[model samples]
Target: MSISTVAKKLPTTAIAATVIVLGIGAVAPVAQATVLTFDDIAPISYFNEIPNGYGGFNWNNFNYINGSSPKVRRTGEDNGRVSGDYVAFNGFGNPALVSDSVFDFNSAYLSATWNNGLSVTVEGLKNGATLYSKTVIVDTTQPTLVNFDYFGVDELKFTSFGGVEPNYLGGTGTQFALDNFTFNEKATSIPEPTLLPALFAVGTLSIGSVLRRKQLNQS
Candidate 1:
């Protein structure tokens, strides 16, 4: 109510404002995970070509097949599906790519279509440049869950190379299947550089308020 009381309260309020600004600056950006199981694609008797814009990513040389489809040979597709009845594979044993503007590749369940111990090379790329790559061996007998944990990539290229070929459904030994593909649609964020100026301004105001209070006490 008095002039001295109001002056004391002014410093406390300014310090609180400075703390609030610092608290906001300390917050980190959160990245949410997105799982693309390929189960959303309608099943055909044989295979379904995954189109662009499916799960917000462009799919190249990828096809989905129903695990129990009559056209699917049981020997080739055995244990290929991780969830639901559908699974995605590189059509014709070609190198495949799943791309977006930017994303974080988390993990995926992979299996060879016809070959056991198939060598699959997965590369993370940004702006047409390779950021990182990992090679993992998979088998048709069971699905191998590979954790990539790659962040801030715009493209993921999968190349299947040498493996043991079995003459069953006439599949190339290089062919591989993908299921339960998980990723983050966005990259993790860093605190904005613009926040620094705001924090500095608030700190200065807090210091000025404290100095004013000291001067009043001295008087």
Candidate 2:
């Protein structure tokens, strides 16, 4: 109801109701960010298998897994990295990583060994169509953290640039890696069980004021 209408009715009750509703909002639970460290996934380095049911099995939580040749370099490994190990794309005449299972990934950090045309693209797909896409060129010798923090998508596609050959030790393809690869976790619109203690205290005070005002009007 409008302010004038509420004021025309029982002012104390309406104001108290508003206060209680706002108190609930102030005490709502918040969503947290989920980071994919790719650290404890063992010493395995190759994400270079076909998707599940074809010749692979979800790549251990990473699904829709299809690409030229992708590999994961674990932390503490002797792989050339800024610090820890990371995942890289091997140029098997083609260097691309595609997936639709990483939902709600806002931004990612990539590490490259200065390979030419090192590009990464992320997109949102719906019903086998491209909803949106963002591409980045990674030409660096260190671990670079790139942000697509503006849009949230259902599908995430990471592709290393082409025209380069695979030489994991010193050449072109598999020398690229993604380290500290992370994403955020978000909560649904569902509300929690109850409000915090402070919100309850304020709500009680608001109700008390309404009762006091009612008594004064009755007198």
Cα lDDT, all candidates: 0.80, 0.45
All candidates: TM-score? 0.80, 0.56
Instruction: Please list the Cα RMSD from the true structure of every candidate, rounded to 1 decimal place.
Output: 6.2, 8.1
Give the local distance difference test score of model 2.
Answer: 0.45
lDDT per residue for candidate 1 within 1-219, as digits (tens), equals 553443454555664565575564456767678888888877577787998999999999998888777665554465778788888899888899999888889999998888777899999999999999999998777888899999899999999978886665565557888889999878556654454454456556777877999999999
lDDT of 2 at 75: 18
Off by over 4 Å in 1: 1-16, 22-24, 166-172, 187-190, 193-219
lDDT by residue for model 2 (1-219), tens: 453443344445544565576554445455565554444344443444333322111222232111112332221112324334434333442444434433455556664433545665655554456767777665434456776653344444444454343244345552345544455433455554243443445546767888999999999
Model 2 scores a TM of 0.56
